[model samples]
Target: GYHELRHRRVYDRIWIEYHLIFSDDTSLQTSHDISHRIEDQVDHLFRKDEVIITAHLEPESHEPQFASTRDEHERSPLPSREVGP
Candidate 1:
């Protein structure tokens, strides 16, 4: 799971700060790649007017113990649901 630390509109652009939380079993390379993918997706969605100031990757163990107890549904890599008008 990822936490959004900060987000704001600055002039003609948007700035964001993100904290990427991963399980301790995840590798550094995988975390890095995920962050890059997040950044790229945000960039693509916002075009040139958005900036991801930081994407800090940290292990779930470093967070409060309760955070690690999220339900299986919350831990899914990507959950899908139908979109209705």
Candidate 2:
């Protein structure tokens, strides 16, 4: 079966299939998170000087999205169904 698909180097260091939505705020928001999640995920593939890439995820899909900080970043992993096709 041949069809369009996507590939992304996620912060998790996984080669995930991704769909991109580009925007000014989107980029900014992503960079903001990397500044926070950076420490925890630093040992992964992400380059220390590299910034994060942002996507406009469906609202309420991932909550309490931290633009920065660690203590506040901890909430809960999203339920499987919360992220969908």
Candidate 3:
């Protein structure tokens, strides 16, 4: 069915939500791999232990500052983050 203008917002919201662009395994896999490499270079990079979470889209709670999600496909390959060393 062709899209109608009336349902644009609704459709867009739903499509954005519940979208699993990347599986949990993949996210954790990449996260771990990147972290590993960083740790190899710096002895205690992210060694304090933390839980990383990736939602389908931006968190519905607060504006995303550090974490990223499988939200925007046309933006970047991975869940974009504002993290730094």
TM-score of each: 0.73, 0.19, 0.25
* lDDT computed for candidate 3: 0.32
lDDT of 1 by residue, 8-27 (tens): 98776888787778888999
Per-residue lDDT tens digits for candidate 3, residues 25-84, read 445566455544333333233334332322232222233322254243323333445446
Most TM-score-accurate candidate: 1
Best by lDDT: 1
Alpha-carbon runs more than 4 Å astray in model 3: 1-26, 44-63, 66-85
Q: Which stretches of candidate 2 lie over 4 Å from their true place?
A: 1-43, 48-52, 61-85
Number of backbone clashes in candidate 2: 0
Model 2, 1-85: lDDT tens per residue? Answer: 0011243554544332222222234455664453334323432333443434332232222332332332443332222222212
**Ranked by lDDT, top first:** 1, 2, 3
Better of 1 and 2 by lDDT: 1
Predicted structure 1, TM vs. truth = 0.73
Decoy 3 TM-score against native: 0.25
Sort the candidates on TM-score, descending order.
Answer: 1, 3, 2
